[model samples]
Target: MTALNWKLVVDTRDAQTLADFWAAALEYEVEDATPLIDHLLKAGDLPEAAVAEHNGHRVFRGYAAVRHPEDPYDPFTGIGKGRRLLFQDVPEPKTVKNRLHIDIHAEPDGLETLVSRLESLGATRVNEVDKGPAGHWWVMRDPEGNEFCVA
Candidate 1:
């Protein structure tokens, strides 16, 4: 099979809000789809109902994304081709434990500082787990309760 590009997709109550949190947390850049959104609207290829003003720019109403700051992106579409996370709005709230989660690795001796920063950004500490010889890490939840680990 040919190589495939991939991105993590997450469901959120508010795409923009979640994107904002993740962007700041990861020091990533929120994808800018304003130009494409505008062009599509003008060409009648997109409906106004599907787009809305967010952070002062047009974005898809039900979706938002963040990309690694140095990643390459399609200039006109603002779509990232490298590491990315896409958030899409969903009517249902998160009600179960995450089947999959992200693990953030901090620079040596930086875990504590990273944890503090994440807490300031609305992450809540769930608990810390220490596995003999395997190391220890902190379990935390995002603003919307999605669990992730910091090590």
Candidate 2:
């Protein structure tokens, strides 16, 4: 058997916005790809049209990512080598329930507080659901309407 690397890839209308949201939500760090972007552009491997300025630094227009704060990353490429979420631009909007969603676990008695914090960050509370012994959870959506749960 072979081990494999993985990271969640999400579709978004605004990569930077989504990356920022998730980075804060998960206490992750937004990967800084400015140096790589500059190098690539200078080498003519990445065209000027494929990049944009975000927070005073260059980033790939179609993609951005966040990494777990403790994870290792390639300093030159700003690529995360551990837990990560990559956001890529898509022309269409999200119009349906997500087949896959993230579940955020709160510390004991922390659910309400966490929910409020997420709301302040542009997340909407969809509803709360109770499943008997299985416990209760809140269904929420990110700014771009990606579904996730908090319990």
Candidate 3:
């Protein structure tokens, strides 16, 4: 079977804000998408209502993304070729626990520092867990209430 390429899509109230948060949290770079947007606008292919200005650049109104800094990307569209997270605006709020969540592994002896940094980036610590021989970790929630973990 051929391997399929993919990026994680996250629903958010504000794509830009969520993208910013995740980018900082993961040390990733937000995808630009400026050249493509500008070209589309000038070619009458995209409507102004579907566009927004973020960080002084043109972006899709209800979408934003972040990618690993070292990942390959298309220069024209600024789309990532690997390791990306795409955020899309949604009208409804998160009402239940996420069945799928991200687990971030911290360096040895760096869990506390990592958790504190994430907190400063707008993450809330739900609780800490320590299982005798299993492991130790912290349950955390992002600004939009999406659950993730630090271990």
Against the reference, the lDDT scores of all candidates come to 0.94, 0.94, 0.96
lDDT accuracy of residue 17 in candidate 2: 92
The sequence of per-residue lDDT tens digits that candidate 1 reaches over residues 1-151 is 9889999999999999889999988999999999899999999999889998888989999899999989899999999999999999999999999999989888898989999999999899999999968988999999999999999
Q: Judged by TM-score, which candidate is best?
A: 3
Shift of residue 9 alpha carbon in model 2, Å = 0.7
Residue 29 Cα positional deviation in candidate 1, in Å, after optimal superposition: 0.7
C-alpha-based local distance difference test score of model 3: 0.96
Tens-digit lDDT string for candidate 3 (1-151): 9888999999999999999999999999999999999999999999999998999999999999999999899999999999999999999999999998999999999999999999999999998999967999999999999999999
- TM-scores, one per candidate: 0.95, 0.96, 0.97
Q: Better model by TM-score, 1 or 3?
A: 3
Most accurate candidate by lDDT: 3
